[model samples]
Target: MIEKKSITFLYRTYKKHWPLLLLALFGSILESASMAGLAYLIKDVVDDVFVEKSYEKLIVITSVLIGIAVGKQVGFFLKNYLYPVVIYRALREMRAKIYNRILRAKPSVYRKETSGDIISRATTDVERFGEISSTIGTNIITETFTVIGIIGVLLYRDWKMFMIFAFTVPVLAFALQYFGEKRKKYSKRLQESFSQYIQHLNQIVSGIEVVKLFHEKVFFRYFNRINSDLFKRQKKNRFYETVYLSSVEIVAYIATAGIIFYGGIRIIKGEITAGDFFSFLGGVLILVNSLQTLQRGAINLKALTPVVERIKYVLNLPVEDDKGKDFKGLKESIRYKNVTVKIGESVLLKNINLKIKKGEKLGIVGATGSGKSTLVKILPALITEYTGEVLIDNVELRGYSVFSLREKVGMVSQEVFIFNDTLRNNLLIAKPDATDEELIQALKKAKADFVFRLENGLDTVLGEKGSRLSGGERQRISIARIFLKNPDIIIFDEATSALDVETEEYIMEEIGKYFKDKTALIITHRLKLLEITDRIVVMENGKIIEEGTKEELIKKKGVFYRFSVISSS
Candidate 1:
């Protein structure tokens, strides 16, 4: 993680929000100056007016003090009211930057990373960024100005008396300086440990069924011990914060005592008036204490470094951008030749060659983990770094553009992902510009028009991942989505396997109509799907084991015959 000044990042991110920020700084300075000015008027009223028996001077000084008090109230409202709104604006801006990063990320990026952690990084990371994003700027402005303005007044009252306030600031400053690194270090550790705990919490929730079936009740006990250890470590961190704040209070009291004792002697010797001596002491008390308050908040900010770092680490990560050529008017077939995939020391695929015509149905089949899905993922330009010559017409896959290929391709996977939104919107996801008439036609073609019979019709909100819908209904919607897009090519990866035999047959009939004159590719483990595909390609261990028409492959009595035998069993 890189070390950036939180204050600088906060300001640069939201300079436009500074109108409120300016108001806060102005109000704080005026309020601090008013207090010191009121103290000056008190000394004059007691000594020059009452003690010297001058009533006229008393009225004027008293009026000025009253005006300062009223002015301070107005300043306080304008200043205090501005901060939270400014903080809100800053938070939104930073959240937008994180959101934009996610939008620009390639789908492959998520495959290479953990989405659960990435989601936390976007939300919790932005929140952690918020910890520093909102506060440090305003604190630097108001606190610095307030402390400085108050101290200036104390010096003007009596430079010699100002020495008492100065001596103690260094003591508090030393405490803050002494504990700064320790506080930051502990805070960093606590944040990292908490993130790890959060990761574990997600893993357990996702695997609750497995845990239940296995009857691992004692697993929680082990997890509890780990969490308990983390809790103890966090408690230890707060101890450092306690020491930092406690030290500030100690310095403040010592300074308060030093001022009174020294000033009391000055009054007795006639070196300063009794009223002047008392007012000077009061000024010293406020100024010294304000400095202490500033240090305390800074220590708290230092305590947040770990969380801020975690957030910054993610937001600063490189977001992938689709810089591929625009394919608004593409007129070419896709070709794959000699594609190879190797991970570490393991070779997943070797020297695979194939061709996909612009409008032809191509079926890819293989055993589980045979790289069937991996091969399909490459067409969308998902997997970029592989040794191969994939061409859009004659243009190399790497030379042409990702956006160009994506524009004409649509895929429906075995594990369907549906957002919690209207049924209409789910279909419109394929083509946001599609109209109600167009949507219904696609739905009818995919045999999903039964959605209109529901209570909400197109407005029906399918729960997350379409958990509210039955397996067949979800697949129909998935098919309707691709039908709505009417892309040049479609890849169906076991899209109907979960359905009953009759439902799967009905779906197959519906899909054949949808793909009648278009290019369609189906990867199916069920032999039922093979009857629909014009050609069959059997894949074993990532290479094409055999390929022919359904009758041709069965007649060969090889891998396809063995596959049929296994299916019957």
Candidate 2:
């Protein structure tokens, strides 16, 4: 039995296509009833033309058969035509919904799942779901009616023949149910195996340079292993399909042969006419065809159950708590009181208390894994699963809308992600309504005039992840975006670490001027970048060990002194 929830969800999803659904249903009725009508007309063609020698009635019977043929053709056309519209439309809506849900999901949800798995669910799984949904929708209605009409004709013609065929129903039902569970089991496994294969493929393609340079044979060995597993899994799934279909065929043929033998004996005993025997056999054939179709439909729908569950899991995940009121720019202070962040059994940040006044330029220096990036990430509510209090202007961090909170915060990280789009469009992400002149001015502020040399200037398309641009050029474009955004708080998480010394120096000089009045938090390995900041905080082992003015920290000769000495060396 299909769950009520699944039925409700499917109905709501395609409610707008109900008119097409109705037309398809009407078509199926006409198509199935025509076959039933033909079986009834066979008695006339057999009895009247052969026994009575009635030539006049022959013209009427042929005309009626022609009309039934046309009706069936119209029905076939309607069912086929409406099905694709529903399939593609549902696919488009589902893809859009999944993407939107992914955006609204918390960062931790992404950490738990691989990008390739997510992509497969959105593309491959969604396509399969679409096909199953269309098949279930069309075949369920069409085959049900086809079976009913054919069975009704059989019972009306002769009860004995109907009883003989009905005896096979329980046996076929058990067979279909057993194989359907098997198909469902293998279908889920096949989908999971494909996700793993896609993940490996994505990894190899993205890191092809590394594989070619150092580990070609090792990578190929891994690739071949996954490929072989996929082949075996696919073959196993196909084997079950073949067995299920062949079993249905064998059972149906046995039932048909038994009905013919029994009915022919009755006709010879003079208990029924030749027309009656032939008409009963025709209905039996239609019933077998309808039964096969229904079995296939059932198996397909059962196999898709796991996919529907996967989709439901994603769609039902808790979206970020974005319900709070709008947040204007920061006015007073951002404070963290005894905040701690934990991931599984490991604690990333422990009882880290700190505060940054509005317009304060704070510099943070720490070794890798010291939680420097995680600290600043909390300000924008990007990493929300933490203990203790984070307040913005005396309000709890969760009190402000996440989207509104992010609007006030701008971040430029070491690894800048550039989409495969025009530079103009990339810049537009920060300020969509920015004019070309405004964009150029922001670019100038970030020392990113290199874009002007591109083939189409601002309109030039960057390669995937900005692959065509040099590292410095990509960094500059990212900085230009931040300048255009001009948020109240700016965060630089080793933003210039990827650039050469010359590029870093020039970019930092421009950034120094840009940070004049805005609240800035700079996390850098190069201690020299801390010169423009008002205060510096040194973190080690997820705790702020020392914090003071740069001169004061250098004078203390504590952790800051050792960091400075290492930087100079």
Candidate 3:
């Protein structure tokens, strides 16, 4: 469970207008006062006109009743409309805070958590908070204050009944608060279970191709189990709620019965008139109903505490580590010292040391399962909290902010992804301000000319992740984009591995030309690409085994040369 501080912090992060909440309280008082006044008027009409046979005050009584009605409606309108405005604004503020937290979360956080869990919290959890925020306040404020007002009026009219009612009411509150504890725990579990269900659903949907190929309906058993659990929890919650509601109704019924019996005795003894008893019974219903709603609202407030805490957990997560305050670019080198990248118990890259000079085209080659990708992942400052230092331009990597570090480096992964937009729009992402001539120049540089021959030149809409294009086309577009952006440093994660011999060769020339002086880090199995690179770094078992220029390493026939010879052969 998230701590109390987190929930309180989120609540404080977006404050509601105290004036509005107070106004909601005020409107409720007016509305309840009007209602309570009606009962008094009825008592007066009966006692003064019916029993006393006085017709002179009838016109004044009628006007007073109409005025109460109008005032109640007006009070209701103000409370209903204005209070929701505050609720909506609070919701918007919370959603924004959660989104910013997500944006700045550490990479370690994402690798451990699921996209679906995060998305569910942002969408469903926040929406529930909004609904909770809107309703809980009105119920707690209006119902509670109204009930108090009725009790005060009753106490003034006849202290004995009010005292008895107070004694019984606490028992109902205790029952609700008791049940409320259980509800809060289960509500948290329900959200957690739903998160799990969402996480598993994401895994299944993403791997649907595997499921279909294997024809495995058995794989869906887990989902079935989750659904059953959710159903059971929901039923239990409903049952507990029903018990609380039944108790509240019983309290109302018993109070009514007691009022009838006691008021009748008083009337018979002539201590209180029949007219006052009639008005008292009506007031009793209004007061008890208000208390009932307030009791239920208290339970709901308890139930929503977990959601508020969950939202706060995400919203209050420390914004990702600040990039250093240093302003120097990576003109000299970016060096790593005894760096260890660990994900919880397992380390991805361990005890590594390396450096890349400015204008250095560094090729990082390793066998599959080696930490080649992890090593490059560090340069972009993607994975921090490693064992050692990553320094750029003589300043510690920690000294640079994420904005400064990422702004200077652009990464192109082996897996190509394009937005569902026009080809031109996708390429324009490289340089949003780049001219058409500049864009075409970049496209040609990255060997992306073939895309122009398509029906929509640059305006053509690409389907989801460029599903509209072939694998080679997507790869070329990514390359063209990197070329256009022209960041100071580039990390190519097997960027050319998806291409065939012909496309690879054309891109090899264009890629080398475009990234001539930029600090380039290439993670690839194709060590033969080292021919065009200025330096080569070999990694094995998360350790830097060797480093040298291609020709220099080839003559030695070390690991780089061996892979090179095999790839060539």
Candidate 1: TM-score? 0.85
Model 3 stretches with alpha carbons more than 4 Å out: 1-16, 48-59, 106-125, 174-207, 219-244, 303-309, 320-347, 350-355, 387-395, 399-402, 415-430, 436-474, 551-558, 565-569
- Candidate 3 lDDT tens digits, 1-569: 33476457545744557777677767877887887787667777888778987767777787888999998987787677767777777778777888888988887678877887788788877887776665655676677667766766676666776676667777767766676666667776787777778888888887887878974667667778888888888887777767767866776788778878887888898888877777777777787777667766655555476776677678766677664584435778888888888777777787888878898888888788678888887767787758888878777877777877777788998777689998878888778888888888878877776877879777889987787777777888898888888888989898887788777878877778777877888887775566677888888888888888888888888887888888878
Query: lDDT of candidate 3 vs native?
Result: 0.77
TM-score of each: 0.85, 0.90, 0.83
Residue-pair clashes per candidate: 2, 0, 6
In angstroms, the error of model 3 at 479 is: 2.2
Residue 397 CA error for candidate 2 (Å)? 3.0
What lDDT score is found at residue 107 in candidate 3?
74
How do the residues 354-409 of candidate 1 rate in per-residue lDDT, one tens digit apiece?
A: 77776667777788988887778777777765688877777787665677677777
The candidate that achieves the highest TM-score relative to the unseen native structure: 2
**Candidate 2 Cα errors over 4 Å, as ranges:** 49-55, 111-125, 175-199, 227-242, 303-305, 321-325
Give lDDT tens digits, candidate 2, residues 380-436: 887887999998899998899999989989999888889999999999999999999
Q: After TM-score superposition, what is the CA distance of residue 265 in candidate 2 from its true location, in Å?
A: 1.2
CA shift of 240, model 2, Å: 4.5
**lDDT-based ranking:** 2, 3, 1
